[model samples]
Target: MARKKRIKIYSSNGKKALLLSPEEITIVKNDPSYEKNYEIEFNKGKQAFEVRNYYAIGFWKDLLFVLIGAFLSTIAIDYFISITGNAGLFPGGLGAIARFLSIIGANNITISASTLYFIVYFIMNIPLVIFGFIKIGWKFSTLTLIYSIISIFFDLILQNIPYINPNEFSLLIDYNLISSLPGAWGAIIWIFAFAIFGGMINGFSYSITYKGNASTGGSDWVTYYYSKKLNKDIGSLNIKINIFILFIVICLNTIILKTQHIDQTIKLSAIYNEYNSWNELINSDLGKALDPILSAEDKVSIDLFNSWKNLQTGNWNNEDWFNISKYISSSSEYDSYYTSTLVWKMKFKWIIGPSLFASLTLIITQGLTVNRLYPKNKILNLFISTNKINEVQQYLFSVGYTNNIFIWRTVASKKNAWNDQEQDLIMISMPLLYFNKIEDYLIKIDEDMIINIIGSKAVKGKNFSYTFDNELREKALTEEFMNNGKLMKKIESNTIIKTHKKMKKNGVSIQNEV
Candidate 1:
C-alpha cells in the first residue's frame, strides 16, 4: 500500500509548522500539483499577513476620519434643523413613499414597530451588503458589520446613559450653537464639511481593507462593485455616492419628523427631558393646571395680524375702539401671561441649542455617506488627551473611573485574569479616549480609591492611579462634559481648562452662569 501522503507548511514565525497530509493540502487547493499549489497557498498567507499589518497602520488614519466625519455631520445636521426646524421633510413624492410604507403595516403592523422597522431596514440593507461582498469578500462584510454594530451599540448606550448626552457634551464650554449656523449658506458648508471628513475616513478604511483584499462591504462595496464593473475609478465615485446617501438620510429625517408628527414631541423631549414617562396623564388636573395658556395667546396673534392688516389699509377707527385696541396690544406685550410664554420659549431654545448643533454637525459632514466624521466636543477631546501614560493615571483619578487596572500587565496576567473572569469593561468617562491607551502598565491597586499608592503597570511602571472625578462634578456634568474645554484655550492656557476638566480640582468654567 502507498504510504499515507503527508505535506508540511511553514509559518512566517519559523518556530512552528503545520503538518498536513497531501490530501489535506489538496482539499484547500484549486490545482492538483502539491508543490505548486503549496507555494501558491504560502504566498497567499504571506499576502494576508502583509495586509493585516497595513490594516494596523491604517487604523489611526481611519480613526482620524471617524473624528472628522462625526464633527462635520454634527454641525451639518444642526444647521439643517435650525434652518428648517421640525418642518423639514422630503419634497412632495418621498413623503408619500414613507407614508405608504407606514400605512401598509410598516408602522401599523401587529409586530412591534421596532421589529417591523428592523425587518424593513435589514431587507433594504441586504442588497448593499451582498453587492459589497462580491467585490471584497466575507472579511469585508465582517468588518462592516463590526463597525456598524459597534456604532449602533454606542448610539444605544449613549442614548440610555443620561450622563453621556451628546448635546450638552458638544457645548460644554462657551461655544454657542447659533454661531455655527451660516444663514442661507449653512447647509452647503455643513454638507461639505461632513462629506470631506466622512469621505476621508471611508477612503482610509477602504485602503486598509483593500490592502488586506477585504472590503467594508457596505457603501464601500457599492463603490468597489461599480469601479470593477464599469472599469471606472473607485475613489471619487465612492465618495459621491456616500455623500448622496447622506443627503438622502437628511431628507428622510425631515420627512420622518413631519409625517410622523413626532418632531415637536422630539424637540420637547430633547429640550426638557420633561416628559420622561408616557404614563404621565395629561388629563390630570395638575397636568391641566401646568398646561401653558397659549390658546389665548394664539387668538391674540390672529387678532393682531388682522388688526395690522386693517391698519395697513389706512381706514379710520372709532376713538373708543382705538383706545381699547391700544390697551389690549400693551397687555399682549407686557402682561404676565406674555412674560411666562417668553420665558418658556427661551428655556426651550436653550435646551435644544446643543442638540440642534450636534445634529447639524452630523448632517453637514454627510456622516451617513462617508463615515469619516467623529463627533468632536469636550468629553472626546478630554478622553484623547487623557489616554497618554502620565495623563491616564490622572484621568482615572479625575473622572473617578475605577476598574482592575493591574489585571492585564502581561500575557500571563491577561490569561490568568481573563480565566473565568467578569467582563472587563473599564468604564472610563469616555471610550473614544481611554480604549487606545494604557495598553501596557504595571501594578494592581484598589478600585475604590484614586491616588492609589500601589497600582502601577510593571511594563511602564508608575506609582499611583490617577485622580477621580469629584462628586459635585459627577452630579452636575455629563459624560460628554469632558469635551467642554476650549480647545484653543487648552492649547494656549492649558491650566485654566484643566481645573474645570477635573472636578477634583477647584475651578469653575462657567462663572457667569453659576
Candidate 2:
C-alpha cells in the first residue's frame, strides 16, 4: 500500500490538532503540494464562517436595548405583584429564581425581605452569566450581565421613587373594578385583564431583549443555551423550563405549609404542657360531679379532687388566676391570628398568584418564542380582478406594500356576454397590519370587485418588516388602530365641518353639501 497519508484538523479551541488518515477524511486531498495550502484555506474559511454567524448589534446599542428591556420587564413584574399581592406572580423567567432566593434570604436575614429579595436575585444571576459566557458568546453574556445589573438598579430605584412607594402602589383600577362588580364578574374581569396585559408586556420586553441577541439572564440564558446545543427551538425549550419551575414552586409551597403546620403544632404542644390545666377546666360542672365519686384513699385521685376543690372554693391565689387568664387569652388571640394569616397566605401565595403567573408566563413564552423563530411578517393574500388591479397595486405600493405582489395573466369570465371584458388576475401578499387599509382601498376603487382575502402564517422576503420590531409587533397583534370605516367617517366629518365653515366665510351657499 502507498504510505498512509495524514491530514490535520484543528479543534474548536484551535490549539489542539487531530490527525486523520487520507481514507478517514471525507474530502480527498489529491495534490501533495497543495496539502498545506488546503489546511490554511480551510482554517481561514472556518474563521470567516464563525465571524459571519455570530450575532452582535454593536456594543452600546445592544446594552441600551437590554437595559430598556430590563426596565420594562421590571415594571411588568411590579405591576403584577401589586395587582396580585403575590410576588410569586412575577411571570419573567428570572422570577422563579428570584422568588426562591427571596424566600431563603428572608428566612436567614434580619433586613427588609424586599431589599434582601432583590439583592439575592442580583447575586444569583452571576453564575448564569458565567455559564452564558462559556457556552454562548461573550457578547451575549456581557449584555445579560448588564441587563441584570440595570434591572436590579431600577428595582431599587422603583422601591424608593420620591412620592411613589412600590410596596404601597396597588392596582387601584383592579381594586375598584373588582369591588364594584357583583359576584365573580369583578374577579373575572380583573383576572382576565391582569393575565392578558401582564403577559403581553412581559412578552414584549423579552422580545425586545432577544432582538439584541441577548437575555436578561436566568431561564433566558438556559433556554438559549439548550436551544443552540440541542438544535431545538427556544420557545419550546422555554415552555418546558417554565413548566418545571412552576412545578417546583408548587412543591416548595406545599413543603412550606407542612413545615409551618408542624412548627405551629409544636408551639401549641409546648403551650399545653406549660399551663397543664386551667381553672376553667378544673372548676367546670363535670369536674365538680367527678370529684365526689373519687376515693380519698387513692392519692392520685385525692390530689386531683383537692386541686378541683381548691379551685372551685376560691382558695386559689390572685397570681395563679392572673397567669391562667393571661395564658388562655393569649392562646385564643394566637389561634385567631394564625387562622386569618394562613387563609390569606394560602389564598394569594399558594393558589391565585402562582396559577396566574404560570398561565401568563406560558402564554407569553409560547407566543413570543414562536414569533422569534418565525421572524417573517404575517401576510394576507389578496386576489383581485384585473380591471381594478392597476389601481389597487398602485395604491398598495404607494402605502409601502411594494415588497411582494405577484401578478398573473388570466381570463375573467362574465356571467353575461353583455359585460364581457378582459380581466387581469392579480395576487398581492400584503402585510397583515395593512390588510384593513388595503381592503378599504380596493372597495373604494371598485365597489363590486371580486376580492378574496386569504390569511398567511408568514411572508418571507427582503425589505419586509419582521415582527421582531417591538412597536410593529405589538400593533400587529393588538390591533390597536381603529377600524378603517370608523376612521374614514371621522375624517369625513372633520373635512365637511372645515369645508362648511370655509364656504360660509366665502359667502357661498353650500348648506346642502354640509
Candidate 3:
C-alpha cells in the first residue's frame, strides 16, 4: 500500500496549524483540486485587507473631524438665532398664508399650510438619502436608519422636558424674572449649549457610520448620488446640499410660525366660548345648589336686594335705601372680585413669559463657531479627559476598525510618588501584525519572519522599534518581541533547508519555491 499523505488545516486567526487526515490532504493537494482551494484562500485575504484599510480608516478619520468641528458649528448657529427673533429669521412665507386664513376664517386653508411644511421637509431629506446610496452603494442603507432613529430620540427628549416659567416661581424670588434681559440671556446660553452638544452627536454619528461602510440614512445619499451624476466631487456636493437645505429650513420655519399663531387664535376663541357657557350656568336659579350656605353678610345683602325692589320707583330717601347701603358695605363681594382678577393676571404672565424667552434664546444661539469658542489657548480648561479618548476609540471600534492600540496619559513622574531625581515619561507605540498577512506566520520581535502579501512575494519583517518618536510615518515588523532570537532564527533556517531538500528529492526545482 502507498504511504498516507498528511494535510494541514489553518486557524482563521492565524494562531496555529493542525494536521489533517490523509484523505483530506489528497482532496486539497491533488493537482487540479488544490488550485481551487488556493484561489478561495487568496480571495478571502484580499477582501479582508480592503475592508481593513479603506472602510475602517475612512470611518476613524471622519469621526475625528466631526468631533472637533460639529459642536462649534452648532453653537454658532444658536448664537445667530439669539440677536434676531424667530419671527423674521424663521421662514415667514408660511406666516403670510396663516395671516390670510385668520382674516377670512378659513380653517382648512390653515391646516393645508401646516401640512405642507412636513411634506417639504420630508421631500428635501429624501433626496439626500438617495444621493448617499448612489455614492457609497446600497450596502450602507443601515447607516441612514440608525441616524434617523437617533435624531428622533433627541427631538423627543427636548420636547418632553417641561419649560420653566419664571412667573410661576415669582413667590420664591418675588421678581419679574421672565421678561427681564437676564432671563433672556440665560435662555440664549442654554440654546447655545444644546446646539453645540447636539451638533457633536450628529457629526460623530455620521463619521462612525461611514467608517462602518455605511451612512446616516438621509440627504447624504442624495449628495453622493448627485455628485456622481454630475461628475462633481462628493465633498463639495455635500457642502452645497447642507447649505441649501439650511436656507430652505429657515424660510419654511418662518411660514410655519406665522400659521401657528393663527391657529392659536382660533383655539383661544373656542376656549372663551366654553368659559362663557359655564359662567352662565353659575348664575342660574339652580346655581344656589353649588354655592355654600349663606353667611351673615350674604344673608343681609339678600334681604336688602328684596327691600330695595319693594321701594317706590321714585322714593330716594326711604329706609330701603339706607338698608341697601349698609348691606353693600357688609358684603365681601369687592374682596372676592379683587382676588380673582389678581390671580388671573399673574397666571397670564406665567403662561406667556417663558415662551418668549425661549424663542428669543433659540434665535440668538445659532451663530457661534467651534474655532471661536474653543480657541487653542483654552486647551488647559478643556480637561482633556481620559474618558474623551476612550469615547473616540470606542467610536472607531464601532465602525469596525480594529482596536490594536489604546492611547492614554499618566501624571508626570517624580512629583509625588517617584524620587526627586527621577522624571516621568509618557509612551505611545503601535502594535505589530505577525501572521502571514493571511495565515500562520511567525512574528518574533527579533527573528526574521516572512509575511505573505497578496499579489506579491513574501518579504522579511523590517525592524521598526525606534521608528516612533522619530520621523517614522508608518509601523513595520521587526520591532516585535522574540523568544530567544538566535534559536528562532536557526529553527526557521533549518526548516526551510529541510523543505527545499524534500522538494529536490521529489525532482522539483528549488527556484520555483513559494
Predicted structure with the largest TM-score when compared to the true one:
2
Candidate 1, residues 153-204: lDDT per residue as tens digits? Answer: 3333333456434433432221223223323234334433433443334344
Full-model lDDT, candidate 1: 0.35
Q: How many collisions between residues are there in candidate 2? A: 1
* Ordering by lDDT: 2, 1, 3
- Alpha-carbon TM-score of each model against the true structure: 0.32, 0.44, 0.30
Model 2, span 1-514: residue lDDT tens: 7777765544434454445464533322232323554445444543343344334325666667787788877776656543443223444356665665566666677644445555666788878877887877676887778777787677778778865645566543544334333343354445556666666666677767866657766677777676555433466667667666765664564444421222222333333333334364446443343344432436334444555445557676444434333333223324432334343444334343434444555456536653754342456777877577777765655444545567777766668677656777777765554464346656788776787879887645445542223233324322322233543333333333334344446674423320
Query: Compared with the true structure, what per-residue lDDT tens digits does model 3 show for residues 1-514?
Result: 9765544433454344445455543433443433554455444544444445545545454444343333222222222221122322221122222222332332345422222322333344565556554554443443444344343333333324455222122212222222123223453344344334434433443443443434443445655455435433355444445444444444343343432221122222222222223244235332232233222336445765454444324344445544433332233332232223333433343233333333323222321221233221121101122323444443323322321343345443344764433222212222121111112211222122222223212222333221111111111111211233653333333333334444456675323322
For model 1, the superposed segments whose C-alpha errors exceed 4 Å read 1-126, 167-218, 228-514
Each prediction's RMSD to truth: 26.1, 23.1, 19.5
Candidate that scores best on lDDT: 2
Per-residue lDDT of 341 in model 1: 39
